[model samples]
Target: MRQDKNDHTNYSEVAQLRQQIESEYRAACEGLHGLAMRARHDFIQARMQRVEEYYQELSSIVGPEAAITTVIKINDAFAGTQRKQEPQP
Candidate 1:
């Protein structure tokens, strides 16, 4: 490709601007990641609490086998959601 000869563009200024924008983007990404982590933690904690309550209730109604199955289902649901939220290549 033939380059332009009269290209007197201020590349240094552009480079500085790019660096500033990239730094801001990185900081925003970090903040988002922290928020996501907290949200995921809270969701899992609430889920586990509900599961414990359900397990107790179901155990009394049905049996230990049913309780185990319910627990497995709860785990599978969380795993599926986490997988969906993960980044794809």
Candidate 2:
């Protein structure tokens, strides 16, 4: 049916938007870490604001549980990378 086709298209669009937002959120977090390490307080605050906005947008699209899951996954990945880069004893 035509309605079924439209529904599928809408679902696809939502999926794409969710993915784009998630990627932006990941990039913002990565940049925020660098800013914090460099002691760029002003830039870090601004970046943190942007990161919160990204979370709100993602939550609107995918619900809070899914949005938080995405955040947790990204954070875990970053933590793992940081651990690997730390100097060994």
Candidate 3:
């Protein structure tokens, strides 16, 4: 099977990034951004469900919190992509 360019060759790198992000998230004590957090958590759950059905290998790589952050990033990236795809008026 052909590997995608985004596929992880080192799971450890993913784990390490997750750890770092979790540290930053925990250190955030501003007590704001709750709506964003909720949206991220919801997206993460949906993402994990799809991953379980599609990419079984990566299904276990993310926990709830990590998955949430990842989902947020994914959404942001997708939105940017969509914006780029639109024709400028």
Q: Which stretches of model 2 miss by more than 4 angstroms?
A: 1-37
TM-score against native, each model: 0.45, 0.60, 0.34
Tens-digit lDDT track of model 1 for 22-63? 343334333345455544554545545555665665565456
Runs in model 3 deviating more than 4 A are 1-62
- Among all candidates shown, the one with the greatest lDDT: 2
Worst 10 residues of 1 by lDDT: 1-10
Whole-model lDDT values for every prediction: 0.50, 0.64, 0.47
Displacement of the residue 53 alpha carbon in candidate 1, Å: 1.4
Clashes of 3: 0
The sequence of per-residue lDDT tens digits that candidate 3 reaches over residues 1-89 is 33643356446656655445433333231111333434445455554455334222323565556666664664465556546756799
Q: What is the descending TM-score order?
A: 2, 1, 3
Please give the TM-score that candidate 3 achieves against the real structure: 0.34
Model 2 agreement with the true structure over 6-31: per-residue lDDT tens digits: 77875775566556655654555566
Candidate 1, backbone clash total: 0
- Top-TM-score candidate index: 2
